[model samples]
Every structure is written in structure tokens, then in C-alpha cells.
Target chain A: MWLIKHIPPMAKALICFTFVLVITSVLIWLLNPVIIPVLVSLALYVCLLPLHDWLTNLGWRRDMSAMAILFLMMFVVLVPGSLILAEFNEQAMLWQSKASIAGQSLNELLGLLSEKLAQWQFHIEVDQLKANILAGLVKDNGSFLSSISSLVMSISSSLLLVPFITFFLLRDFESLRNKSLNSLPNKYFELGWLMYFKVAKQTQGYVRAVLIQQSILAVVAASGFWLAGFDSPVILGLIAGVLGLIPYVGPALGLLPPFYLVLANPEVGFDAMYTAVLVIGVAYLVDNLLVIPLVVARFANLHPLVALLSIIVFGNFFGILGMIAAIPLLAISNIVFYQLLLSFSPKKFTTNVASFH
Target chain B: MAGSPFWQNLFRPDHKQKKHVRDLWLATPIFSGVSANQCQQLVNDMAIRRYENTEAVFKLGDVGIGTGLIISGSVRICMGEKVLAQLEEGDFFGEVALVIEAPRTATAIAAGDTQIVFFLRPQLESLLSRSPRQGAKIMQNLAKVMANRLGSTNTLLEQSHVAD
Candidate 1:
């Protein structure tokens, strides 16, 4: 007891940090199954909360309002999602055949390029390079296909639980929040309340902005591709829009499918490839110049480097879903960490300020 | 009475809690003229906290973000070593903090074992966003409360000057 009481403050802080880390890791591991649904519900709840409140203010019952929102989601999101999945599956099969044909063409193109380069005295092993590239592509695609199927299975199972969880969250979120707040001890109450408010505001704004940005990009890309006479305009547009959720490298990745399509189809011609590139270029311009500045940048406000690093780190841990969620998660953590520091070390913080002054 | 099951059941309030909380909100000045449904919505955002005797509700210089309504006990508001006021059931303190981000002007301590309901600023902002009319009513009431406090403070100041 004496030793414990006499422990250095730095040691005590280290112990506290370790304790919090262990607890967080354990909780995350235990709750991994439900985490995605719960997080999705939270995002949905933040987006829909104003509507829910308006309905309740109009004298509609809480349960009734929640039900209305749930039905609206089913019609607006779920219906269209299913349609897109169906279209995407059809496109996937078509692409599988086209991919083999494209491999052959790629080999021919590489051979011609290698011959031209040989005239310039640049030695190149065209066949070996083609074989290595094709094998790598096939392996990557196989892994991606397997991962996609497992992801779908997990999502389908969790989708069943989402609506139910969302309803309760919408109906009872205020009470639940209050209950949580009431449980905080006096020492932590102010910090907890501040952190909760900041994190919620930041996260809700980020998610709302991202959704709006994605939707607008999808529509614009789809329209541009369709007007340019690209086959599977909707599929291409959807892929572009979805991939655009990743910052920095997403737009470039979005260009690949249409580029591959142009290369694979002899009928598409060089004109079609140029048109595809132009359309993607226009979309990229609109995204960076208009949608991002007006809709997303104000809310996200993340440094480009931070956003890129978060995508890499989160993508490593959670794959595609992690990459998609990285920005908002990083924003929340930043707010929480800043608040924690302000709250826990006010004296030291004040002393530093005083010294500066 | 503390151990009596009948008393416990009466106080426990399983089914009637919502109605009870709504009624309690209705009796408060800030919630007056608000509809029962609106009151219920407000009540949903309130947290009920229990404090032991002599426990601090809030300390001077702490960041204040909400108002606390006395529910079943008394609280003493103090500045430095001087008691400013003793508040009882239905009285509220720190209301100005709910509307503005600032530090607590005084410390509030429970005079006895107490129950208080808190109405936090974020919830109030949400209420304003959802229903401006209801939010306006509460804001108007809050304005009146502040005006009344200012009037009293002015009178005290005037009296002090006259005495000097």
C-alpha cells in the first residue's frame, strides 16, 4: 500500500495507459462480430437523427418515427444496393472473359514495345515480363474474389441485425447517452461530456459529407461515361464512385476498369479509350474542384498525409472496409485524444501556457 | 420506511417513470408552456444523478456545460468561502452555462444526500435543431430567469452602495 501510494506520477500514468490499452483491445476483440453493424448504425443514426427528432416534435411516437426511417432506408438504400449487386455480378462474369482476352493483347502490345525499344538498344525480356505480370494479376484477382465472397457473407448476416439495432438506437439514443453520462464519476464527468460532444459532432459531419460526396461523384461519372458511349456505364460509374471513397489514390484506381475495357475490346478502338480517359479526368476535376471543396473538405479537414497514412494502416487491419472507414475513425480518435489530454493534464497544460506567456 | 417494500415499489417507478419525469420537467420554469410530448423529449435527454452528503456537484473554474435541477435534496452554491445561496427542490443552477461555453462561476455542493437531473447543452442544441418553436419557448423562459437574477443583483449592489 505504501509503495503504491508512493509510486512516481509518471509510473502511475504509464500503468493507466497500459490498463486502458489492454481493456480496449480485449473489448474490441470480444465485440468484433457486432462492431461493424453497431458502427454503421451509429453513422446512420447521426444522419437520420434530425428527421427522427422532427417527427417526434410533430407528435409522432418514437417507435413510429424509427419505423418510418427504417422503411425509408429499405426503399432508398437496400433496394438500389441489391440492384447494383446484381448488375455488378453480371459485369464481373463479362470481365472474367474479357480479362483473358486482354491478357493476350497485353502480351502482343508488350512484344511490339520491346521490339521498338530494342532498336533504341534497350534490352527487354518481353515474354518473361508478360508471363510474370499475368500470373500476378490472376493471383491477385483470385484472392480478391475469395475475399469478396467472405465479405458478402459477413455483410449479409450483419445486414439482418442492422435495421433492428438502428431502430432502437434512433428511439433510445438520448436516454442511452444520458445513462452513460450519469455513470461517469465526478472527476471524469466534464471531460467525458466534452469528448462525447466533440467526437459525435466531428464523426457525424464527416460521415454525412462523405456520403453526399460519393453520391454526387457516382452520378457525375455515370453521366459522363454514358454520354461518352461507354458500355456498362452504370457499372463503371459505380466502381469509380465507390473507389473514390479512398482519398489521394482512389480516382486513379477508378480509371483502371474503363481503361482495361477499352484495351480488351477491339471494337472499342483508340477513340473509346481516349473518351474513357477524358470522362475520368472530368470526373476527377469535378471531385477535387467542386464536390470535395463544397461538401467534404469543410467537414473532413484531415491533412492529406494523415488521410493517406490512415488508409494504409486501417486497410492493413480491416482491408477494404477499414480503408473506407479510416478517415472518420481517425477524426474521432484525434478529437478524443485531444480532449483527453486537455482534461487529464490541465495543470501541466496551464503551466506550459504560463511559461509561453 | 427506507426498508419497506411498499415504499420502495412506490419510489422505484417502473412504468410511470416517463410520466413522472415529464411532469417534473413541466413544473420547471424553463419547460413551462412546453407540451407534454416536448417535455417528454426533453426528459429523455436528462440524466438523473445521486450525490452523497457534502459531495461537489460542480467546482468553481470547472468548465460548465449544463444546468442541474434539484430533484429530491438541497444544494448550496458557494464562491470562495462564502455561501451565495441555498437551493431546494425545483430550483436550478448553472443554467447560463447550458447556453454559453464558460467556466463555473460558483461551486455547488450537496447539503445532503441528493438527486439532481441534468439538462446538457448538446441535448438543448439538438432540441433547437429539431423543433425551433419549443427551443424558443425554453430560451425565452431562460431569458426571463436571467433578467430576474440581474434585477436582484442590481438591487443588492444599489443597497450596498447606499450603506457605504
Candidate 2:
């Protein structure tokens, strides 16, 4: 105990840092099944903190306020969400019925493309090419269908878990925070609280800003798609909104789905494809020009390279969700790292003057 | 604490404990003028920590966060080998840190098993934003405490000068 107390504060800090990191890693591993839902709940809690605070200030009990806010969240999110899902389901069934004709048209289109390329001295076998493409798509489709069942299961579980986690978090998070912080040695107690508050404040701001910006972008993109007469406009807009959160490549990735749909359906004109391109371009323009400036003011301070690396790394590990979460997570990590590093410096104090000022 | 019904207790396990602490805080210098409801709002996020005998609550040169009220036992404020003040229950120290991010000027060590309730800056800021009236009363009381301490120190310096 004496030796521990005598250790340099920085050394103690480093030990504590490593201890927290290890505990977090182990907890993440242990809670893997419910991790996504927990994260979603936490993000929702952050977004709704102001509302909850307002309710509590109105003399509402914490439990009752949390319950009311949870219901509000469910109504706001689920109503629109269910409508979009229903529209998407109808569109998906229609597309499924048209798959045979679409496949025939796609083959014909590819054959014509091969001939055009051959005219430019880029000779290729259309039959072999079609076979390979069909094989790859079939493989992907099989895997996609297999994954859907698991996705459904995960969603079902999250439906039950998100509200439960969010409710408890809203009601008792402060008490939980205080209890955990009390375990810190008195020396680091202040540091812990400072770090916790700094991290929480920054994270809450960034998450709320991002959610707001994305929702607006989704609306803009969906509106543009509807104006351009695209199928599954809501779904496409949602994807574009999510993808737009990524830095450089998001807009291009957002273009792929509508373009692919255009190619699969021969009856859809090239004019619709052109309109899709123009609409996406304008949608992203609004996002960069209006939404970001108005909602977020400044983007995360990460270098383009860092943002790209995070997107690639997270995308590789966790796929689309990881890609979507990467920048925010990186931004948060930046804030945490900055705060922790700043804490290590000795606090500055002014000297006492002889005369009262 | 155990007398509450199961649901209420489940939702707020520390309800009784918090009420007891709030009553104690009402007597502290910083909360002297604050009403019960105001005190409850102000102390909503205060944490009670227990320290064993002879343990250092904080040391000189450490960054101070906010004030701590001695809920039980006693704490001795010291600078090096000097015995500055012996504070018992209901006394509070480190109030200056609530207004400024400064290193502690002295160390405080527990005389025995001591329980202290901390009102940190974040909670104070939160209170200020949520209910300015309560926040202003506490801040006013804090200023008075600091002023009283400064007046005493000035008097002591003048007495020493005369003796010299």
C-alpha cells in the first residue's frame, strides 16, 4: 500500500488506464451478443438526455420521465420505420417476381456491352462472362439469404433489449457513475470525474449532431429519389444517409444501388438513371453545404487518411455498421485521448498577491 | 431503508441514504441558506465516500475538483508539518476549487473512519443550468465562507506583524 501510494501519479494513471482498457475489452467480448443493442441504446440515451432532464426538472420522477421518453422515442422511430419497411417489403416482392425477366434482360445488356467492347479490341467471351457473373451473384445471394435469418433474430432481440437498457440507463446512470467513480483512489477521483464529464459531454454533442444531420440527409435524399421516380426511394435514401456519414467514398457507394437497379430492369429508361445520378449529386451537395454547416458546424478533426483507415479497418471487421460507426467512434476516441493527455499535466494555479485585488 | 416497498426500493435503492445525506448537507456552511428542496436539487449528484483511519483524503499539489463535507469522524488539514485546522462533522473544505481549477494548498487526512459527501463542479454547473435560483443561493453561501476565511487570515497576519 505504501509503495502504491508513493508511485508517481503519472505511473498510477498509466496503470489505471491499462486496467480500464483491459476491463473494457473483456466486457466487450463478454457482451458481444447484446453489444450492438447496448450501443444503440446508449446513443439514443445521449440524444434524449436533454428531454429527460427537462422532464425531471418539471418535477417528474426519474423512472417516470425515462418511461415517458422511451415511449416517445418508440413512437417517433418505429412509426416511420415500420412504414418504410412495409414499402420496402412490397417493392422487394415485386422485384422478386420480375427476377426471371430481369435476369434475361441483364444477359442481353451484357452481351451488347461485350460486343461494343470487342469493337474497341477488348475481346471477351459473353457466355463465359455471363456464367461467372451468374455464379458469383448466386453465391452472394445464397449467403445474403442465410445471413437474413440471423439478422432477423438479432433485430428481434434488440427490440426487447434496447428499451430495457435505455430505461435503466436513463433512470440510474448517475448513481451507477458515482458508485464506479467512488472506487477510484482519492488522488484520481477528480481526474476520473473530469475525464468522464469531458468524454460524456463531447460524445453526447457529437452523437446528437450526427444523428440530426443524418436524419435530415435521409429526408433530403429520399425526397430527391421520390422526385426522380425511383423504386424503394425510402430505402435508398436511408442507405445514402447512412453511407454519407463516411467521408470520400460514401456518395459513390450511394450511387451503386440505384444504378444496379436500373441495369436489372430493361423497362426503366436511361433518363431515370440520369435523374438518379443528378438527384444523388444534389442530395450530397445539400448535405455538405447546408446540413453539416447548420447542424454540426465543423466535421470531426480527423485527417482524411485517418478517417479512411478507420473506415477500411472497421468495415473489414464489422462490415456496413462498422463503416457507419467508424468516424463517430474515431472522433470520440480523439476526444478521450485529448482529454487524458491534457490531464497528465500539472494543474496551473496563480500566485497569491500580498494585497487583496 | 428496508421499510420501503419492493418497487420503490428497486428503482431507488439509495433513497433513504440520500435523504439522510441531504439533511446533513442542509447544516453545512455552503448549504446554510438553501431550502430543503433547493438543497435536494443541489446535492442530487453528490457522492459519499468512506475513508479508513489515517488515510489521506487528498494531498498538497493535487488538483482539487470541488468541496467535501465531513459527514462523520474528523479530518485534519495540514501543510507539510504544520497542523492547519482540525475539522469535524458538518465542516467542509476545498470550496475554492469549486470556483477555480487550482492545486490543493494543503493535505487532508482522515482521523478515523470518515464519510465525506462530495459536491463536484459538474453537478454544480448542472444545477446552475437547471435551476439558477438554487444555484445562486449555494454560490452566495460559498462566497461568504471564503470571505470569512480570508478575513480571519488577514486578522492573523496583522496580529503576527504587531508581535514581531
Candidate 3:
């Protein structure tokens, strides 16, 4: 351990980074089941930082301000969340009925395609194909329901834990950070603060951008769905908004629900599907052209390949929550790595260039 | 900065010592006229570190982000081989860094095992946003300290010129 002191500054940074990464990974692995709640609390902590600062500026003590913010958040979320859940429940029941008819129609369409293929000497077996498809669907549905139930259980547990964690984080995060930095050797202490502030600022901005991006996508998509005359515009909009957080494939996935609903009324199905597609297409175009460029691009300028790879890897390990968090987490990591790398550059040791002094 | 558990427990700063350190901060020109309660609040945001004897607190040309107040023992401020000043208990160095993150003009090393409290630029910025009145008072005091130092330096220059 004393040998660490003799290493070059760049090496020290690398060692520190590796140690931190390993510790974090191990902690996350150990806390795998509760990771979601912890992550949610952290996200809430970051998102509410500005409001926390504003309240403290108004002469409120940190604990009181944090408490008030938590209360405000609960009120803001619960009221709308309950309303949305009710609407979603009603729409979901309707969708379930429509889905059965849609499934039958899709099977018939597939059968027709198989018949046409048989005429071309493809030797298609429509009956066998249909049976296999039904079996697979049943199996998938069974797994999906189990997964959903487990997800609900975790979320219910998290609902109790998130506030308690966020409260402590809100009140004591700075001191906690300082205490952690206190363990650093004297030589790296200032550098530690520099990195801490830089990372915190970047992460905060990225989280804020994500919140705004998600809201815009949800509002725009829901409005579009409503315009398309869908019975469950809000639910569809919510799904689309969340899915749209994913990069390239998300917008396509967002199309599935409306298409399913359209299938129930086969005569006018194509017309409604076309309208829905156009509406969503315009929304996606606006997001890519306007919102993403202005809000998210400034912080999360990750390569498409990197984003996709990260999403797949994280999804495999952590499921849907991981997929949603992949981009932001990746961006934060990139910022930390970049800052650590910057510490190695000789240019940084130069005299301050600020005109203020 | 980790000490053996035995040594850590042995040298652990007590409430009395901490209060004494706060009192020392209150006496400093940069914190002059600040209320003790306000000083306590500001001090809560600062950091303290212990340096071994002959250890460099910071080296020349190192980026300085904050001022350091010696809480115990002594510090030797030097440039190259020349001794610039020997700062004792309650003395502060690198105060300019609190205003701007300039390179430290001189290196500071501990004369003995020394404990120093740091009031960094980031904390100052946080204070400014969170409690502007307290922040402004400290900044005002900091300006006055700089002005007095500049006046003394100017007088010293004038005296040398007249002697020549």
C-alpha cells in the first residue's frame, strides 16, 4: 500500500478508479435485489438538488428542506400516478379483449401467407405453424406474468425504502462525500474534490436532461395517440414515452400497442394504423431533430454502437431498469474517465487562467 | 491519511479542540466580524487533515483551490531553497486560492505533525449560493485582507526605493 505513494500521478488515478469501480460493482452485486430502489433514490436526489439548494437559500435548514421536498415529491407523484393507473387499468382490460381478436386475425394472415408460400413449392404447413406459435405465446405469457409479479413486489418494497434513503442523501450527502474524500492521502485530497465537483455537476445536468426528455416524449406521444382516436391514449403514451428513452429501436417498439389495437377492427384497421404511425413518426422526428439535439446531446453524446452495446449488456444483466439506465450511467462513467484522464495531462498544472483574479 | 486505530483514537480531535480551532478561525482577518454561529456553520463545510513532519502540504506550481488554517503545530512556507515564512498555529496560507484557483506561489510543508483546516473554493461557492449574506461577509473580509497585504507590500517597496 505504501508503494502506491511512489507511483506516478496518472497511475495513482488509474488505481483509484479501479478500486472505486470494483467496490461499486461488488456493492451493486450484493445489493442486486434492492438496486432499483437505491438507484431510484439516487436519481431523485440528483433531480431535486436544485430545489434543495433553493430551499436552503430561503433560510431553511437542510433537514427541513429535504423533508419538505420529499413531501412535495410524494404529493406530485401520487396524485397523477393514481389517476394514470386507473386509466391504464381501464384501458388494459379493453386492450386484453381486443388482443385476442387481433391474435386470431394475425394467425389467419399468417395462414394465408403460408398457403401462398406452399404454392411456390415452399412446402409450408400452416396448421403446424399455428400450433407452434400458440404454444410459444402461451409459454411467453406465463413467464411474462411471473416477471411482472416479481417486479411489482420489488417496486412495492422500494416504495417504502426510497424516501428514507433520499431523506438521508438530501440532508447529509455533502458531508458523506467529504468524509469519503477524507480517506484519501493528503496529496490527492484537492484533486479528489475537483473530481467530485466535476462529476456531480455533470451527473446532475444529465439527470435533469433525462427527466425533461422523458416528460416531453410522454406528453407528445400521448397527445399523438389521443389524436389518432385510440381508446387508451394515456397508457399508450406512457409506454411510448418510456420506450423512447431507448435509442434506435425504441420508436419501433412503441408502435406495437396501437397496431395491436388496430387489428381488432380489421376493416378500418389499416387506416387507423397509418394515422397512428404518422403521428408517432412526426413525434419521433421532432424528438430527434429538436429535443435530443438541444437537451440530451450536450451531455450524452455517446456513439450509437456504444449505446446499443451497453444497452444489450446491461439489459442482459439487469433487465428493463438497466436498459433504461444504460445511456445515462454510461455517460456518467465517460465523464469520470475523461476527468481522470484529464488529470494526467500536463496542461492542467498550469497557472490559473481566470480573468477574475 | 489513515492512521492506525490506536493512534487515531489517541489523537482524535475532541470538542474542546474543535471549538478552539473555530475560535482561531474567528480571529483571522479573513473571518473578522463574522458571527461565531455563522463561523461554525461555515466551518462545518470545511475539511481538516493531519500532515506528518516535513511532509509537503502542497508544492510550488500546484493548483491551489483553497486556504489552509494551521490548527496545531507549525508550517514552513518556502520557495525553492529560500524560506518565505514560518506560519504558526492559527495562521492561514493560500487565501487567494479561495477566490481563484491559481498555482500556489510557494510550497508549504509541515514543521512537525500538523493538523490544518481547509476552506476550499467549492465550499465558498456553495455557501454563496446557499446563504448569500454570510458568503458576502466572508468575501468582504477576504477583500480587506488582500487590500491590507497589498498596502504593506507597496510600503515595503517604497522604503527600499528611498534607501537606494
Candidate 4:
């Protein structure tokens, strides 16, 4: 009798879990095409809202101010960013070509060694294992470059689309919010709006803080690279800025490229390696010791494990945008999803704050 | 103040309960008779505005479109390019336009990097409709303001006559 009673609850929980997972998967898959641009526009709108509020206070006409800010974004960030990205495109292609040659040479060398070792060892699987490892590495490099280039191309093509949507978003933002809030079922409107604001405030705060950390790291890393006698110092710096977005693994990944560039050159090899290592050290200390705790910790209220998981899952579903946005979106979803789960059932969670606005 | 953790705050389920505008006591002659509830309602309805130093709020005759509540900042209310008054927190102006739905008579500019609460005409209309008692108190407040302006005009006229 006791087991029977609990079975229903267990079954209900399983059903709910399946239902949520299905819905989330469907939503992410269906929204895949427009997801990135929409997300980028969302971020742009959020970052610029403070400026819009300032201009409104100055009593500059809203339309005029919004338009001016749009142009400013293009001039100050996007255009220069695109030009720099073009250089990265060329560099990425060059790196792939060289890395492929190196990879193939290494694979052949390994194959010969594995074959010789297998003949001598009598009954070993060395050759097969070597082949598997070589295949995996080759597959990874090819896919990585292809995916990155496609992303860059898509971003550039859709670049014009962002400002148009962003301007409208900023312009009609408040009125749209009011209408949406008011139109919700009367019983839910106030709570829903409160939740909306809370999520927005938290997400904005986190992104702002993280972006500041990225910029500071970018400058510091770039300066280190410049001093290291690296070619394309500015480009390396810009790359550092973008990589700085990826939290823990970003700095580590960033170290590889400069390290390789140094390794490839004979004259500046050891010195370059040492400098790149130093750059990563300084960057890591700045981020973890001071920046992460002081800046990102306040805004991004979720724990690091949660942050990392969000990036992995979201990136799996939505690619780059997911990678950039996983933390904030997860934080928001954690609250909203938990609230929905609780309200629809009698099982209230201990951490009510996670879901309650 | 970057990266500041959120300080805990007590949540008021209903902000309106905490204020009664009519019971207000302040140095400004304009709000003398208003109730605490009315003042609170006005504060709730007030729109936020912010500006940096040397930023202009509005140009003269740009249709004094909305009322302002000096929420936590200051500004210069100019008339035909003359510096008519420099107002600070708790001060309000351009209210006449919202009352009568008229073009702005003066351009209010920010004297320094400032923040103000703006009350647009349509929003004010909705707010007034929401509370008739508060609306009446605001009308009374407006009458006192008009009387003060008239008394100032009369004094200016008397001084001009003496100079002549």
C-alpha cells in the first residue's frame, strides 16, 4: 500500500521531466536559424539601454537618440570588429592549412612507428589505436575551422539585420513591456512582470560585469603579446578579447595559438613561449583573483558548475550564442522553470529563491 | 560602484500604503495642502530622468511636453533663453502643459549631470483618473503655483514702473 501510493508521485515526476526536456529540445531546434542574430540583438539592446535612459533624461528626442546610438555601435564596435574579423578569417585559414600539413606528417610518422612496434610486440593493438587517435584529431581540426568560418560568414551577412531590430527593440521596449504585462491574465500580470524585471536585471548585470572583465583582460593580454614580439599584435589582442568571453577554458585555449606561433618560429621560440605563459598567468590572476569575485560574481549569481553546464548544453543546442549566453539564460530559466514546476505541483523546493521572483 | 552586491531590502507589497501626499511637510509652498497619499501617488507615477553635466534637457519652445519631478537631481528651467530658475530635488515644473495640454512655454535644461522624474501628459491623465481625490489635491497645488507666478509678475511690473 505504501509503495503503491508513492508510485504515482514518482510516475508524475518522470512524466514532467520528459515533458520539459521534450519541449526545451523542440524549442531550441526550431529556433536554431534565427537564434543567434536574435540573441546578439538582445544583448546589444540590453547593453545600450542605460545610454538610452540617459539620453531620455537629457530630453533628447527618443527617436533621435536611439538612431544616434545605433550609428555609434556600428562605428565604435561592429565595423572595426568586422575588419578585424576579416583578418582572423585569413589567419584561421592559414592556421588550418599549416596545422593540417603538420597533422598529416605526424600521423604518417606515428603510423610507421606503430606498425614497427606491433610487428615486434607480436600481439598488440598499437597500430589500430594510433590510427584512431590520428583520425579523431584530424576530424576535430577540420570541423572546428569549418564551423567557425561559417559562423563568421553568417554573422557578417546578418550584421545589418541587428541594428534595425535593435533600434526598434530599444524604441518600443517600454511600451511593449507595458502592453505585454497588462495583457497577461489579470491574476498573473503583476507577478509575471515582476519576474520579468528580475530576470532582466540579473542577466544585464552579469553580462555587463563579464564584458568589463573581458575588456580588461584583452588589453592586458594584448600588451603582453605586443611585448613578446609577436606578429599581428593587435589581431592577437583582439582574439584575446573574444576568447576572454569563455570563462575558465578560454584563457587556456587562448594560450595555444600564441604558443604555436612562437613554436613555429625558430628565432623567437622559447622567448615567445615564456611571454605567452606569463600573459596567461597575469590574465588568469586578474580574472579569478580580482575580476571574477569582484565583478562577475555579483552579476552572475549562479555557481561556476552551473555556468559551465549551461555553456555546454546551450552550445550543443544553439552553438556560439549558447556558448556566450548560457550562463544568464540558465540563471533566468532556473528561476522561471522552478517556479512553474512548483506552482503546477505541491512539491515546493527548499531553495524557493531559485524560482521565486 | 561596480560589482556591488545587492543589499537586502524589505519588500513593500503595496508601495501606495506607505505614502499619503496630503500630509506632506516641505519648504516648497506648492505642496502645502496636498495629502500624503496624493504625494505618494505622484511619486509612484513619476518617470525617471537622468543627465550628465552640460547636457541640455530641452530647447526653448520645444513644446513643454511633460511635467518634471526633481527626483534626485537638478536642472535649469529656462524661458525664452533666460535662466528663469535652477531647481533641485522635490521641485517640479512644466506641469502647466500637462494640466492644460498646451505647448511647452519654456525649455528645461540640465544645469549639471542630473536626474529628474518626468510625468508625461497622457501618463498623468491615466494616473489622475486612477485617483480622483489625489487629482483634486493636484488641482489645488496648481492654483497655488499660478497665484505665486501672478504675484511675482506683479512685483516685476512694480519694479519696472519705479525704474521708469
Q: Model 3, A1-357: lDDT tens per residue?
A: 787556777776687678768987999899887787888789889888878999987779999999998788677765666567666656655655565676676677677788888899887676677556444332244332223334444655567677778888999998778777766778777777766776676667767776677778888888988877887788778777766776666677677667766765576556687888887787778777755666556667877788889988986776656777787778777766666655554445544321111
User: Each candidate: what lDDT?
Assistant: 0.72, 0.72, 0.74, 0.60
lDDT of 4 by residue, B23-87 (tens): 22233454555555446545554334445565566543333435666544578866545777888
Q: In CAPRI terms, where does candidate 4 land?
A: incorrect
* Reference-based TM-score of each model: 0.82, 0.78, 0.79, 0.57
Tens-place lDDT digits, model 4, residues A75-96: 8868876887788778766665
How high is the lDDT of residue A355 in model 1? 9
Q: Identify the superior model by DockQ, candidate 1 or candidate 4.
A: 1
TM-score of chain B of each: 0.87, 0.87, 0.87, 0.70
DockQ, per-model, please? 0.22, 0.22, 0.30, 0.02
Local distance difference test, candidate 4: 0.60
Per-residue lDDT of candidate 1, residues A1-357 (tens digit) = 999767655566566556655876798789898887787777778788878978987889899999999998888767777776667777666766676776777677788789899999998888788776555333364443333434444555576577778889998887677666556765556666877887777777777777677778888899999998888899788777867777776787677778667657767665676788788888878777865676455556778787889898987788767777777667666666555544444243211110000
Model 2 lDDT, residue A69, Cα = 80
lDDT value, residue A4 of candidate 4: 45
* Candidate 4 or 1, higher lDDT: 1
Could you give the interface RMSD of candidate 3 in angstroms? 5.4
A270-295 per-residue lDDT for model 2 (tens digits): 45778888888988887777544543
Candidate 2, residues B31-119: lDDT per residue as tens digits? Answer: 87778987876566676776677878887766677888887899998876887889998888888878776677887999987878898
Where does candidate 1 chain B have its weakest 10-residue lDDT segment?
Answer: B3-12
